[model samples]
Target: MSDEKNDKDRRGIQSVEVGGQLLRALAHHGHPMALKDLARAAGMAPAKAHPYLVSFGKLGLIEQDPASGRYGLGPLALQLGLIALQQTDPVRIATPMIAELAQRLGLTIGIAVWGTRGPTFVRLEESPAAIHVNMRHGTVASLTDTASGRLFGAYRPADEVRALFEQERLLGKLERPRLAPGTPAAPAPTSWKEFERALAEVRRHGMSRTEGAVVDGISAMSAPVFDHAGAMVLAVTAIGPSGALDTQWDGPVAQALRECADRITQRLGGRPPVPVRRAA
Candidate 1:
């Protein structure tokens, strides 16, 4: 019995491992594929791959489009992915990283998730030399007024974000406050078209920025964390005093935030969205 167990461990099933290549190929392509194309992508002959596809179809892991005869991930595959994401605690995965980032950058690091009301800060790591910023766990952010809020606004569904934005606007949440000392006053969007441009810029840069908008003398940058479905699930932001924090789009602090967000996304088996390109 011991010898049999050892043999099993040393030489796991090869057939199943080979079949996984087909699933991986489908995922990598990110679209439905013809049988021959899929087989080639999986590095197998069509005859060799068809059997596995049939088995996977029966298990509901992959489905064939009858009209086009293309194969794609099926309902069971989607369900499994969603279940995995549901069980994943993004905050738990991000806490230590944010703590380290705060210490390294000497800026307050925070994690925000889309809460019922708005972007809600769930975790915070205050730098030893951090200034007084009115933020903490459970603090809800303003959609048009904070980096984290704009990050979500940029990535979340348009209708939902718009509804919340209008709600906030009605409550006077969209008003831009007076700028902090020496902070340049960038105009906040006044119309829906202008708001879209702002969000598009956020998507283009893969981050968001705020200068004394949320709190006086405070500046911040935020980057998004996405899940495997290419949906944003969290936002990581860094905050510091206006002069102390560089707000350049590609500055060191912004780079660090983007990198940290990317790491967290990757840790959760997620993919970053492709950068939005300007019109040719």
Candidate 2:
């Protein structure tokens, strides 16, 4: 009985949904479309689609070209898109997801966005068994060595990342790594060549991982969240005590992190980029 009621609650107007398919097709194609092509893309007969287009045009949701008879999104659609973009907050949309993931995976989950300096944590959900780390909402992660930072380094503009790295280096921040007392000595400061390789690995796998790089005993994996323009708008990261977190690229934790990021991207009406491929 509950399931049936839920199903009924989830139902929406069928005609509205059908009409939306035309809008979706136009958006997907990203240009004006002929009546026949639009109807075929929307999987409706042209006659059936014509009435919907006429109604949409009347409402300012679509426009038809007088010279070519092509259909395109109208002023109302552009206004709606702009409004949606303004209200789309990746951190707010991702908070609940990361909270649930933190509970399920028994690790810490965080959302980071491009801050004034670099990738800065805006939301953090620490698990019950959380490790003793000194991270908070405003903590700016290291771009060269940390999983969260490397994610931005991988997907963000090259000049921007290079500037940040150069600044950190000049400040002596990247000269030496800080490691936990019992953790083995931190690896050498990353050279440009090494940094490029690290980011390439991240792009190839669609995520980034670091073990004992940021903190001696903590391991983390991060995935990028993109906006409608395919821009890397956020980075979702999961961290925990090193051995306990399963930091392997193909491990369950990494998979969960990527899935969570993908959900956030979809929520924003965004799409994740295809993984980078190496030349044969």
Candidate 3:
């Protein structure tokens, strides 16, 4: 009995090690690969690798192109990645960094996640000279009217953003008067073409900003946080009095906010999208 148990344990460890080698090889390549190449990368004979590939495919960890015979990570891999990202505490990971940024920049910082209602603040850090903006944890940002909302809209799927926009529009219509007494409403987009153009600009800049759009005297700049699958998982935003907050998308505050968002993305094993350079 003892000998049988020891043998089973040895086989289990060997199986895990072999499986890990295949996974590492696929990750190192960063793209779909032919079976021969994949086997070579894993230092295994093609015959030896085929059995493992079949098992991995069965388990949904790898998928093969029917026409090309190339293999890549599959749906289960993406699901696992998203699950891991969800398990990682964004607020816990961002709290200290945001606090440090607030102190260094003398601005209030907030981290928001895509909540059921909208982009909801999960963590906030206030500078000594912070302005009294009516924001807090769980406060849902307006999709059409705030920096954080635009950041989420720009980075997330078009379908999701469109749904949110329709929902907000319906709510506004039902609420009678949407804008307050002295507040001026932002001009509605004249067409879908115009709305997409604005979002494209936001994506190109990798951030968004709003001036007195949410609060009377407040301004904010926001950057997106992504997971390994390139999904926007959170947003990092800095808010302050309109006069103090730099609303320029390329300003120091914007750069700092983007950098902070990038750092958090790295912690979640995510890579930000590479910018495309125009050819001269």
How does each model score on lDDT?
A: 0.86, 0.85, 0.79
Candidate 2 residue 235 C-alpha distance from true site, Å: 0.8
| Better lDDT candidate (1, 2) | 1
Query: Whose TM-score is higher: candidate 1's or candidate 3's?
Result: 1
Top TM-score prediction, candidate number: 2
Which candidate should be chosen as best, given lDDT against the real structure? 1
Q: Candidate 2 — which residues are off by over 4 angstroms?
A: 1-14, 29-31, 40-43, 66-68, 174-188, 272-280
Candidate 3 wrongly placed segments (more than 4 Å): 1-87, 173-193, 273-280
**Count of steric clashes across candidates, in order:** 0, 0, 0
Q: Which tens-of-lDDT digit does each residue in 1-280 have in candidate 3?
A: 9999998877757776887688789988899999999999999988999899999999999999999999999889889878887799766888899999999889989888998887888888886793755566787887777788888878776777777877776665211112345455554434445556667788888888888765567788999888776878888888888888888877899889988998998888887755433111
Write the residue-wise lDDT of candidate 2 on 1-280 in tens digits.
Answer: 9999999999999999999999999999999999999999999999999999999999999999999999999999999999998998888899899999999999989888988888888899987794787777788888887888899988887778878877876664532223434544344455666787888888889899888876677788898999988889999898888879898888899888888888889889898665543221
Global fold similarity of model 2 (TM-score): 0.82
lDDT score for candidate 3 against the true structure: 0.79
Backbone clash tally for model 2? 0
Question: Clashing residue pairs in candidate 1, if any?
Answer: none
**C-alpha lDDT of residue 25 in model 3:** 93
